[model samples]
Target chain A: MSDALPGSLVGPVEIVGAGLIGTSIALACRRAGLEVLLTDSSDDHLRTASGLGAGRATTPDDRPQLVVVAVPPDHLGAQIARALAGGAVVTDVGSVKVGPLAAVAGVPGVERYVGGHPMAGSERSGPLAASSALFDGRPWAVTPHPGSTPEAVALVEALALLCGAVPVRLTPDEHDLAVARTSHLPHLLAALAAGALADAPADHLALSGQGVRDVTRVAAGDPALYGQIVAANAHAVGALLTGVRERLDAVIEALAGGDRAGVEAVLSEGVSGTRAIPGKHGGPTRPTGTVFVAVPDHPGELARLFADAGASEVNIEDVRIDHDPGRPVGLVELTVDEDRAEHLLTSLESKGWVTHR
Target chain B: MSDALPGSLVGPVEIVGAGLIGTSIALACRRAGLEVLLTDSSDDHLRTASGLGAGRATTPDDRPQLVVVAVPPDHLGAQIARALAGGAVVTDVGSVKVGPLAAVAGVPGVERYVGGHPMAGSERSGPLAASSALFDGRPWAVTPHPGSTPEAVALVEALALLCGAVPVRLTPDEHDLAVARTSHLPHLLAALAAGALADAPADHLALSGQGVRDVTRVAAGDPALYGQIVAANAHAVGALLTGVRERLDAVIEALAGGDRAGVEAVLSEGVSGTRAIPGKHGGPTRPTGTVFVAVPDHPGELARLFADAGASEVNIEDVRIDHDPGRPVGLVELTVDEDRAEHLLTSLESKGWVTHR
Candidate 1:
């Protein structure tokens, strides 16, 4: 048997604090065939996570081979200290690292502690929102303080590896700045949009289209946790905000000058440059083919068409439909792969479905 | 023939102007089975757009039923006057309605002037980048001046409808203010991000992620055109900027107090609000789905795995590969519809792939 801290073997992992980060870690760990030891002060959280099979609740006596402390930033330092003091190879998944690092100062065997953050998430939080594949292909940052032993760092990196995450090495300071600009600042901008809209009449919001939605997608994150993220990384976020402010000022100056073409130019720039960012899975979203299908205006017709298309081995990557009750025409737009596009078209054609390029 | 304009059946719809808006509008119009008449003083622009099939060159003797002027805001009023001098229902797709309307001076047959904007686009300019589906499912604002004729307004509204856009009515003042907050201000903010990054070391840009990209998406727009837009809409855009600036000052002040928790609280609020914005196509982009596949450590193994997945009629929504060169095991994450998810899993399972919830 492998002589690890938690057991004679290390097939399972133990996690403390089953909140969003903790539960997600649990989920990712479980997917990797590791038994998980989950411990949360709140029985409710533990019960919920255990119910989802993230892991069974455990105590230190359970002899967890590996322990992860996924707690609030303020509690992170002490928790890591306690875990290390208990002789477990410990890692804390917290957005803020310095404060926690300082908190654990001079703890015996502190070299066993490693700092980590899986840079993937949604606005939602809690165990119920957990999915086993949360960290499948996201960037995970690992920061080893000057005092951390190479062994501890290796274990943290191994954990990241097991979860299928890319381990990006960074100093604590660098990590904070990077997140402020990339994650926290974007959140603040999104907040501005939503807060502005909160005052709008409901009908206006109901009529809002995809642009508004895209601009405010991150606004729905858990309030307190995001607050922590921002406060911890304010300097980096502030720099980004300052840049944004300058641009705003330039735009305002242009508008004041009655330069109609100027404003159009500014908006068009946003359209092009923003598209460069990668979408899901780090792949830039570029449309390969657009196929328009005419379907009958009948209940269950969409399901039937989809089923028929599936039978013909046509995989629809994305689907959007335009319905006008006042007219006999309905346009269904499908985005698909270049290779399979012709096949999808031919399959639909064979099924007598009216379509166009 | 439908001779609504006697001796005026132009080669197609007469589209004056060949900038981004002009080219995009032409693309949509031509795609919808409409013959197009295109004229731009710049032979280069006309050639580029025509080469890309934005429209066909046409003669004035072929009188067209509709003539669209998609020019700079300052030039809109005069262009509308000239287009209407021919007695065809004419319209201008400009952002600011009041300025252009005032410029028109309520000429004879003033009712023929309907000002419209298909509330969609990008920062990229030029006809070469035009797409027929740019305006699909977007909100198109059709603003009618007091002098606009019912038929003229109706014709423009019909055009917007034909292009598969939702028609929303907004007066000139309301349109200006609403856009200042939504479009104009966001442009400025994105520009600021770009400007700041411009000052950042070039290597830092390599570290850029989606957060920076999303927040600064509009900054890369054609600086010249944007200048025109901002200048024309200054009053509204300026006022919105003032509001944003004031809020930002408050945030800075909070942080200065070292009220870390408080600062974090406010910032998190911003993040929560931003997440509420929908993703592409007005849907939540919170990712779902995961795929587990063991990859060998050999070179090109991971690439081959992805290629195989791509070949199996699956669009890999997102990817995460844990890095461990020695025993490189990759857990690939993919997003798929809930229905086809099982089918995909089974197929992978049949091929001896390992998957877990």
Candidate 2:
């Protein structure tokens, strides 16, 4: 184990895949003035990534100080094992950590391998969809196995930093369980909710509102890719699903028995759960107020509304646009600091914008 | 039955409740130069609604031409029944239609009663949260029962139009089932998904991303209110929950058995379900491209970005702000017409904004 301190990682950082995540990491490394060696099974992807200034093609003579495996989940273990044989510190950007870590356990250089998963991605894939800022300010879990050296962990953290992400350290098992609750569980729920709509009558679907749109939004993601991701984290996901099924059964029973209190209990739990989520900036949730403004459905309306909002000097925390059918206007909900909501409402109203709380 | 036309609705429009929907309806009617008579069980709500110019206090001798019942679900049936005794064309803005319709089925003036649901509301309740524009450009389901007269239906449809909404006609049963699928089902699913996170450790919650946030957003609604909602449509909601449970079982079974193909099939159905949702303007879904821009987490940054985006003359269909913990920046995703994405990209890039698709 090389006991490298944070920011002590030197080039060349070899990326084993030239897909979206791999190429994006390579671009970020290049931006940090590091030598990135890129390779891929597909010649076209490698050529395109290198041509885009992500990195140069890897040569047989090149010796890498760090190797990042960014291939599909099935290929992760094999790639990590291959990278480990080169005597370089290895890490992977796979979604699940436990399975892959277990795959490479007892390998000759297992001590030099740390697990990482950057919590950022888009529905689009391939090298063309890569961006240097893909992981900017996102959470990147650095999962270290018991046998992993601190130096290997530090290097993985440094790599996350290089990609403009905040590194959160957790054990490989902990990482799996955490993501299972946050990512896999939510995805499955979304898919299940959305699947019910597949054969729905047009009248039922026509009644769809922003709520359904939001719940089903992520369900539109590529299935095959998510299947592998979920299958990799099955143990943790299965446990959570079992818990969810129990709750579902409770809700069903409550509904059937006309048990309002039972239904409300479940709903109250949901409210608390929503509040449990940390607000932006990773702090306790803050109180916010929403200001609704009706804007005409046109190009410059938002710019105008936002400019007016900016003039109020109230920081906008979030924005949601609700567009209804057969309407020439769209409602824009602006979430702001609770104390400033009234001020924003008054400011926009005074500026001739129709506003509501 | 008078056989009235769409524009034949004339006031005095008497509102049975002075809650959010009732007060908003009063305000909308007032905006259209109608004489509104407001009443509420609570003196404070009545005073507030009347003081806000929503309407005048209801008088004993007033013979209203139309009555809108907007009380809580528990009181909706009684209110609608009482209003029908006044020989007025009655409508209730309750979420579930069948229950209220059934409650007034054999009333003397039942033929004059038409069920209505504005399909618009806020998490915030009471008269203070009311707005004249609440129903503007939104869907208003005009659900008529078997014995409903055309005159009553036309009057209700006119009321929807007067409030700046497009009236979507559905049978009372159809309305209930439709909302059960679109609104209630989604809410329950959101709650179920969010409930799993209630007892999650801080570390697990820290891994939360936009997907989980979006899926769980609606779960934060008032428990008692949602309980009433989900309970009112219990039959339909319960049926959907049963269907959802079957899919859940399939997912759990697939995960346990390591059936990749089974998992992929469920996810694929979700994709198709998401695609079936109509786009804005109540048309088939349109292909839209998302342009992501990094904005500083401060006042005026969004304003500046929107200004630059507006300059490109690309009509933004939607906007989402993703804020990460410990980040001084937020990612703004602007959705626009797919064909014009490149134009907007180049235009924004020329203005020194860092953007990605």
Candidate 3:
């Protein structure tokens, strides 16, 4: 097809599951002008994914140079073993790397397999929701054990590159533990915080605003799907969650005892922790100032604001919409480089935009 | 001065503490064509507020019909008492209601006081950060005790209306508990979650995405100010955090013991809880669908997208920008009414947008 994307990939790439990750990988491969073949346990999934031009359905005679097993955690081991037996370099896109790698350990062709997880997804799942660009600009964790060959790891890394993802190297255990802290822990905590609102009074919830919305946004994810994810990485996630629980308990105890220093310690730790998160482009966090402009909830209003910002030549770092409940007005907070924020604010005000400094 | 803003006020309004809230209230009152006077413990603050044309410096001869004590919680009671003794209808814009109201409960002119907390603010605080339009279309909770007269309650409600805020009525205790859930709990949990990132490896933290960012966004708030806010609402906030801790402990226990059902129960509860939060405009949550578009990091890309959507006549409910680490492109997720999502996707595609549906 398209001269097999600039790496170790020499022939068609076979994907053995046509779910969201699998179909997405297929689409990305196809977009790269590489031949792709897809298979799935469900006939409907295969038909749906192929119908969407993800790839043609796989045939028994198809001899792929590389295979991606994009199946659920419980089936990843068997699928990897099967792909390796078929004489293909293999990788799996399961969320948890350690367990899947562990299951495939000591298999006859173990050296041919590397573990990969594209760190991107929406709450929605299935091939219908898949996109070729899903992994673009995302971190695709490439986990290689001692048994994996250099060529095998390179193939997975090549796949990441072709998919427009940056390859992040980590050992299986390290990857799992890192995700436990950054992803799994936050999801569980979000769920915990959101669960507290399940029984709150109707009027009480009417008071909810952007803060609660942001904190609990991920809690709307499918519990069944998340339950499976958490179960696979339970040991690591459990440890992290336990750590958070202890911190939370200390905070409660401090507040209960009116221990101001203890309370301040925990809250200030949060400030420091959030400060550690990389800002735009994976750099260290830098302060940004906001210029809030009152925008009416109508078509072209946001467009006009951004156009005005464009005219001012001040690059917007980020934007947040704080809609006034039951009102036509929203506050569009434009975050710009701290140095440029004042210029942007004054420019917008000069353009007759009512800006809140 | 223009006629009093459809209220009982017959004289100039006096504002104390000249902070962000106080100065903002003064500006709003002045915008409504009412004369105002300002006082603060710090001369710098008084000067800064007056210099912004918020109001004039208060003098002993000033006889104000209404006095707003927009001071810190610790000083709210005394300020309200002082204002009431000066024969002015009094209210305080302290975040917490019960503690301050209790402090001035038996003062001779307590009947003239009503309690208010405007549900709006920026992380920045001071007269420099104040805006006359700050409270426009926001909720301003009005808490009146039995000692409050009808006229006093009307005066405070009228202030809220003049400030362009919707007045929500609740008892002081009811207000405290409600905010403990909506505001206080989310802040604590955000801080705790962000705290987990403090010791993480830089590389590990680099793997974070929008989910972590949203959950911990407010964790960047000034710890000293938040500490004070938390301290004033300690009992209510502590009780709620304890409940969250218990729920989190249950999750940790389930994960540690490999109890799938227990973990599922907690996660499912989180889903239900988040579902309870009102959507935009304070209506019940509705089904929305998203269309993703790849936008390169460039000035006015967002404006272009919104322009296209506007042309398509699809009202966007919300928009989120997911900046890809180390890439020039970001993914823009446009959420819209479910039925309109397809129209938006097709419309963007027609306009040469590579949309991922």
Residue B122 local lDDT, model 1 = 46
Which of candidates 1 and 2 is the stronger one according to TM-score? 2
Q: Compare the candidates by TM-score and give the number of the best one.
A: 2
Error at B20, model 3, angstroms: 1.3
- Which ranges of candidate 3 are over 4 A from the true structure? A1-7, B1-11
Docking quality (DockQ) of candidate 2: 0.81
lDDT of 2: 0.90
Ranking by TM-score: 2, 3, 1
lDDT per residue for candidate 1 within A1-357, as digits (tens), equals 135542122545779899877887887778777889888999999999999889998854676656899888768877888787767778888986766777887888777777888776543468876666556555788888887777678778888877767777777777776666556766676666556655553323323543444455456566676777676666666666665666555555656665556555545545554554443334445555656676554334554566556666644544545422223344565556656766776787788886545
Report the C-alpha lDDT of model 2 over B294-332, residue by residue, as the tens digit: 889899989899898898899999999997875889988
Q: For each candidate in the order shown, give its overall lDDT on alpha carbons.
A: 0.64, 0.90, 0.85
Report candidate 1's fraction of native contacts.
Answer: 0.19
Cα lDDT of model 2 by residue, A1-357, tens digit: 234454477778999999989999999999999899998999999999999999899888888889999999999998999999999899999999998888889789999999999999976789988889888889999998988888788888999998999899898888999999888998988998888888888876778889999999999999999999999999999999999999899999999999999999999989998999989989899999999999999989999999999999999999999968767789999999899999999999999999888
Which segments of model 1 are wrong by more than 4 Å?
A1-12, A27-35, A201-209, A238-357, B1-13, B18-36, B43-65, B106-109, B122-136, B194-213, B218-220, B258-357
What would the per-residue lDDT of candidate 3 be over residues A1-357, giving only the tens digit for each residue? 224443466558999999888999999999888889998989999999989898898888888888999988889999999998988889999888889888878788999899998998865789998989888888899999988888789889999999889999888888888788788888887887798888888767767778888999988888877888889999888878877878888888888888878878888998998888887777767778888898888877877888888889887777778757757888877888888988998999999998886
TM-score of each: 0.74, 0.98, 0.97
Model 3 achieves a DockQ score of: 0.72
Q: Give the Cα error of residue A29 in candidate 2, in Å.
A: 0.6
